[model samples]
Target chain A: DVKVTQSSRYLVKRTGEKVFLECVQDMDHENMFWYRQDPGLGLRLIYFSYDVKMKEKGDIPEGYSVSREKKERFSLILESASTNQTSMYLCASILGGRNTGELFFGEGSRLTVL
Target chain B: AQSVTQLDSHVSVSEGTPVLLRCNYSSSYSPSLFWYVQHPNKGLQLLLKYTSAATLVKGINGFEAEFKKSETSFHLTKPSAHMSDAAEYFCVVRFSGNTPLVFGKGTRLSVIA
Candidate 1:
């Protein structure tokens, strides 16, 4: 079975503090993504990495950045956390193949900014 | 560019009753559509996908969705609602190859006993 593991399931951070959410997939997938979930707004993509060292901004990339220095691992960075940034963060990975778009997701990390 | 819209924000049904969640999308070309379910505090799980193959697609946990190109709709349905089926459902789309998915403002399903 494919497993996507998130380093932190829950965390609390002070405003203006730097926050990091780490994700790792064991399936050797080539595509990784970061998304933030908010009520009534659904899950909005923050960033995605198709390959090591290559990243793309998604619909809601503001105040967030991502790092993919290695294959199997992706990290989401909140440079300066704020109260509005408090939400559940999800990480997902997909195998890059012809016509394959199924995303395997992690258990999600819930962050509270105070 | 591609976008998805879930018409209803919430739907309530009794256990053993039918379930329906409406979704529509806009894409410049033929799109790949998907339905995902997210339980409270859990990550999104793919329920089904429609990639221009069979218009009607069956998914896990007795769920299904029919893709209608004329209406640009891909609505999810189930024969009967289960208590375990209560969750947030998102309709997603990826316009072209290798593009990230665009998600709709999910529909929350509540199952009543």
Candidate 2:
């Protein structure tokens, strides 16, 4: 069974504080992603990393950043958390080649910024 | 650009009734299609996938989806709705290369007793 682990199940941060959400995949998948889920809008991709030290911006990457220092780990960063940044964050991963579009997802981290 | 469209925002059905969730996609080439279910406060789970193999794809938990190239549609269906089947469904599309999935807004399914 493939397992994607998220470091935090829930988090609360104050405005202007720096926030970090960590994710690790035991499957050693080469591709990792960060997405913020909101009501009605659904899951919007924030950033994705296809390789260590390589990252790409997704549709909704404006208020977020990501780090992939290791093949099995990816981290999402909120430089300065704000109330509007409150949302459920999801981490996902897929094998590098010919993965057939199958994505394994983590349990998700719900963050609330006050 | 690849895109996915989930036709309904919500669908309600009683247990033992049929279930249908409509989805459509637009892609420049033959696309990889998937249906994912997300329970409340949980992560997304893959229900089924269509990758140009068989038109009809059977998935976990007695669910299936048919890929129609002519209509550019991939609709999920189940014979009977179960209480556990009540979850949010997302239609997803992935074009060739290393691109990630393009997800629809999702359709919420509610199962009534």
Candidate 3:
């Protein structure tokens, strides 16, 4: 089974603090993504990395950045946490190829900024 | 640009009642379609997918979805609703491997006993 592991299931951070949310997938898929989920708004993509050291901004990339130093790992970084940034973060990975496949997701990390 | 539309924001059904969640998409070319379920405090799970090989696709937890190109719709259905069925359901569309998956706003299902 493909397992996507999130380093933190829950986190609480103060305003102006830097936050890091890590995700690792054992599947070694070439494509990895970070998404922010909120009530009513649903899931919005933040960033996606198709290859190591290569990243693309998504619809809601503001206030967030990502790092993909390794093929199996992707990290979401919040430069300065704020109340508005409090939301559930999700990580997903899919194989890069001609076939469009469903993504394998992590357990998710819920962050609260105060 | 391709997009997915989930008709209802929320749907309530009595236990043992039939379930129907409407979804529609707009795309110039044939795209891969999927239905994903997210339980409270949990990650998303793929319920089913429609890639054009089969119009009617069966999925986990007795959930199924039918892809109708004529209506540009892929509606999820279940014979009966259970309490465990309560979750947020998202309709996703992927134009190709190069494109990001487009997710609908999602429909929250509430099952009443």
Candidate 4:
């Protein structure tokens, strides 16, 4: 079975602090993504990486950045955390091909900014 | 761009009754559709998917969905509702390969005994 692991299951940070959420996948999938889930708003894509060191901004990329230094690891970075940034963060990976790829997701990291 | 719309925000059903969650989608091209279930404080799990190969797709936990291209809808259904099946259900769509998956707001399922 494919497994995607997130470094932290829960986190708390003060306003204006820097925060990092890490995700790693054992399947060596080429596509990785970061999404923030909120009630009524659904899951909004923050960033995604298609290859090592290659990244693209998603629909809601403001105040967030991502790093993909290796094929197995993807990191979400909040330059300066704010209270509005408190939400559930999800990471997903998919095999980069035309075989109807389904996203394998991590357990998710819930971040709280106070 | 591809998008999904979940018609109901909350659905309540009695245990052992049939379950239905409505979804509609819009896409420029033929889209790949999916149904996902998320338990409280947990990640989303794939329930089923439609890739044009089959219109009626069966999924885990006795759930199924039928894709209707003419109506632009893919609705999830279950033979019998169980308490464990209560969760937030999301409808998702992808335009093509290599693009991000678009999700609906989600429908919260509540099963009553």
Candidate 5:
């Protein structure tokens, strides 16, 4: 079974603090994604990395950045956390194949900004 | 560009009753459609997907969706609702060949005893 693990399941951070959310997949997938889910808005993509050291901005990428240093790990960085940034963060990975669209998602990290 | 729209924000059904969640999409190319379920405080789980192989797709947990090109809709359905089926359901569409999926607002399913 494929497993995607997030570093933290729940996190609380103060305003203006820098925060890091880590995600690691054991399946050796080549594509990793970061998304923030909000109530009534669904999951909006923040960043996606198709390969190591390669990244692309998604629809809502402001105030967020991502790092993919290795094949199995992807990290989401919040430069300066704010109250409005509080939301559930999700990480997903997909194998590099014809069906690169099917994603295996982590449990998710719920962040609360104060 | 691609987008998806879930017509209903919420749907309530009794156990053993049929379940239906409507979703519409817009894409320049033939798109791959997917239905995912997200339980409270959990990540999204893939329910089913349609990639033009078959119009009617069957997914896990007895759920299925039919892709209609005329209506540009992919609505999920099930014969009977289970208490475990109560969750937030999202309709997703991704254009072929490496494009990220676009998700609908999602429909919350509530199963009543």
Candidate 6:
């Protein structure tokens, strides 16, 4: 069984505060992704990393950045959290080099910005 | 260029009844379509995938979806609805090899007793 663990299940942050959501996958998957999920919007990709130090912007990348300094961990960082950024964040990974492979997801981290 | 659409925002069915969740995608020569279910407070799980194989694809928990090239549709179906089947269903499309999957606004399924 592949396990994708999220550092925080829930977090509360004030506007202008820096926020970080950490994700770690045990499968040594080559690709990791960060997605923001909201009602009716499904899941919009924020950023994806194919390898360490390599990142690509997704559909909704504004106000968000990601770090993948190591293969087992991926982190999503919000430089300055805002009310609009309050949503459930999901982290996922795939084994192969191709990004279109079936994703293994983590139990999402729900954020509340005040 | 590539996108998927879930027809219903919400669907309700009584236990033991039939279930149908409609999904369609934009035109693409040969696309990979997938159905994913997200249970409450849980991460999304892959229900089934259609990678230009057999038209009818069977998935876990008695779920199945059929791929129709003429209509460009990949709708999910189940013979009997279970209480545990209540969840949000997402239809995803991948235009080709490395392109990211495009997701539709999910359809929330509600099961009644």
Q: Which structure among the candidates has the greatest lDDT?
A: 4
Task: List where candidate 3 sits over 4 angstroms from the true fold.
Answer: none
DockQ of 3: 0.74
The models' CA-based lDDT, in order, is: 0.90, 0.90, 0.91, 0.92, 0.90, 0.90
* DockQ of every predicted complex: 0.65, 0.67, 0.74, 0.72, 0.58, 0.57
- Taking the tens digit of each residue's C-alpha lDDT, what string does model 3 give over B41-84? 77799999987788999999999999898898999999999999
Maximum-DockQ candidate: 3
For each candidate, report what fraction of the true interface contacts it reproduces.
Answer: 0.58, 0.53, 0.66, 0.63, 0.42, 0.58
Tens digit per residue, CA lDDT, model 5, B1-113: 67789999999999999999999998445778899999986678999999878899999999999999989999999999999999999998876655577789999999999
Residue B22 C-alpha lDDT in model 6: 99
The parts of candidate 4 lying over 4 Å away from their true place are: none
Q: Judged by TM-score relative to the true structure, which candidate is superior, 1 or 3?
A: 3
> Residue B5 error for model 2, in Å?
0.6
User: Which has the higher lDDT value, candidate number 2 or candidate number 3?
Assistant: 3
Clashing pairs in 2: none
Scanning candidate 2 chain B in windows of ten residues, the lowest lDDT window is B93-102
The true-structure Cα RMSD of candidate 6 reads: 1.7
lDDT of 6 by residue, A1-114 (tens): 879999999999999999999999998887888989999899999998877888899999999999999999999999999999999999988754333557788999999999
Q: Candidate 5, what DockQ?
A: 0.58
Q: List, residue by residue over A24-67, the lDDT tens digit for candidate 3.
A: 99986889999888999988999999889989999989999999
Clashing pairs in 4: none
Ranking by DockQ: 3, 4, 2, 1, 5, 6
Off by over 4 Å in 1: none
lDDT string for model 1 (B1-113, tens) is 56789999999999999999999999446788899998886678899998778999999999999999889999999999999999999998877666777889999999999
